[model samples]
Target: MAKKVVTIKNLEYEYPDGTSALKGINLDIFEGESVALIGLNGAGKSTLLLHLNGILQSDEGDVEVLGMKVAENIREIRGKVGVVFQDPDDQLFMPTVFDDVAFGPINMGFSEEKVKEKVRMALERVNMSGHEKRAPHHMSLGEKKRVSIATVLSMEPEILILDEPTSNVDPRARRNLIELLNGLDITKIMATHDLELVSETCDRAIVMFEGKIAANGDVEEVLTDSKLLESHGLEAPVLVRLFRDVMNREYIPIRLEDVIEKPNKYKI
Candidate 1:
């Protein structure tokens, strides 16, 4: 059996103004599983993510990561779980790409040589190896997003949490981001409005609505449910809608490649 990397029980949270953000969320994420958290605005997806790394502490529930309680082992958990925010600008504050990528490893008490190695490897992983000296603010959104990922990658986190990763990028950049995410062999929990990204990169889909988990299941099972998605302010992927609604096909294809590779399977 796969190890459970993150466990949440009866998780609840409310804002300072008494706006309930999360209402008794219970979830478990297994090792090396890529899960997508999909929901509309004002849902509890972001709030739920904040609790994973101890950014938000709910008075009502328990959150555990790597078998360690978040409330008690916050510092250690933060090191092992890296969060990349929705905006690259929010993550990249250092002057240069090298500085931003090296910040995490350096703060973790790594020696100078180790920090250099970590930075180099992280940049290489993101395919930004030769652009270390470039200023992050000057880079395009796509480049900055990769560098933001590199900053977290430098720490060598076991779990990566991303918020709106494909949010403000062109089609080419979005495709690149998806490929990059698919290549990484680590536990990933992403909160996104991009259903296409979820279809291509995640093994499971979790739908959040009105501060609670509306649905949770395999990627194909959840994403293909047009009714469930529609009720919760989401829609099936374009290809799924086309096959089920337009073509009136019983067989549903979740990803674009699925339809491309086996056209006869989806034909009625």
Candidate 2:
């Protein structure tokens, strides 16, 4: 098996006022794999993400990124785990797109030329090749979201952690973001409610409920389990539910792309 890139064990955390945010989360993410962390509001999804890159320290247990402990190796872990917060406004605080994208590399002490190069390459990856001078405040929300991702991409992170990549984006912009993420070819851990995006982008799924990992397994296997989904305030994909009945099979298709593999064997 590949070396675990992100590892957590018995992780428990609480806010300053003693509001328990996470109970105990144990997970392992392999290199270059795409995984989704799905749960309802107040489910500790975002709190768990903060632990990944050492943004918030755990009261008990530990977090390791790239084989280094998050507490002692926060510098290295931050570089390896690029966290794009749920709100782009939280991430893209710089005056201009180029400034925002260049923040990470600049903080890492890259030279001017190198930072500029990284910014350009990251923007190009998001298909926003010429928005360097644009202020983040002036850009639309969708554009700011892409630029926020570019900020992390500029740092060349080993794992991309996105809180909610599709929230509030228009359908067109959401599709564009999906395609952008798909083309990145980097290890990703996304926390989102968009099951459609999860089905299309993630190879595996992990569900969190009240700070506990309620379910974890192959994306198709878990996402199609209507009983499990319903119990956790989620729903099975409509097409997956329909195919489950028509095929008279235990397993259901999770993504439209899967239909191509067995076009005649299954129908919606």
Candidate 3:
């Protein structure tokens, strides 16, 4: 049987001024599943990601990540849930890339030697090797993004949570980021506005609208539902819409590899 990684029930949040952010969100994320959280701005996607890592305490409801409740075990939960914030500038605060990537592991009290090793591995994993000596401000947007992921990866968390992983990246960099995410075998939940990235990197998707979950299902189902996507200020990818024109709805493929590997060839 599959292990239940995170369970959220009646999850709710509000700002100090009583502005509601998340409203009674209920979700279950299984181990090793790659899921996408899609929503328009002010839809509470970032707010929800903060809650998963215990960075933001909610006004109501319970959140359990990796079998541990977030509120009571915040310290432990933060160590297990690695959150990569939307803005690389906000996330990578250390002057040097090495310091930023080593912060998390060091915070967990890893020995200097072990932390060094971990940071090296993390940067290599994100293909940001040899950037350790560079200043965060000196790197390009794409380079900064990878370094930010390295920061979280060095901690070796069980669940990986990211907000707007591709927000300001160029087309080539965006594709590279998607490929890097696809290669990771960890349990990942990404909060993104890029439907194409979601379609390519995630198997399941959850849509948030105005502090509530709008829809949740297989990537293809949620992404291809023209009315649903339109309602949430989104549209299906070009590949998705093109495939839908010819393929049976029951077998709408989401991954690029699926379309390329299949024997039945239809030019889109």
**Candidate with the greatest TM-score versus the true structure:** 1
Worst 10 residues of 3 by lDDT: 246-255
Candidate 1 global CA lDDT score:
0.94
lDDT of 3 by residue, 145-172 (tens): 8888889889988899999999989998
Full-model lDDT for every candidate: 0.94, 0.88, 0.88
Which candidate number would show the highest lDDT if scored against the true structure? 1
lDDT tens digits by residue: candidate 2, 1-268: 7889888999998899978888888899999899998999888888888888888997599888888999999888888889988889988878888888998899899999999999999999988898999988988888988998999999999999999899999998999999998898889999999998998898999999988899999998889888899999998777787777666754467877777787666643
lDDT of 1 by residue, 130-174 (tens): 999999999999999999999999999999999999998999889
The alpha-carbon RMSD values of the candidates against the true structure, listed in the order shown, are: 1.0, 1.6, 2.0
Candidate 1 lDDT score at position 17:
100
Give the clash count for each candidate: 0, 0, 0
- Evaluate residue 112 in candidate 1 and report its C-alpha lDDT on the 0 to 100 scale: 100
Q: For model 1, give the RMSD to the true fold.
A: 1.0
What TM-score would candidate 1 get against the native? 0.98
Clashing pairs in 3: none
Candidate 2 regions with alpha-carbon error over 4 angstroms: 245-251
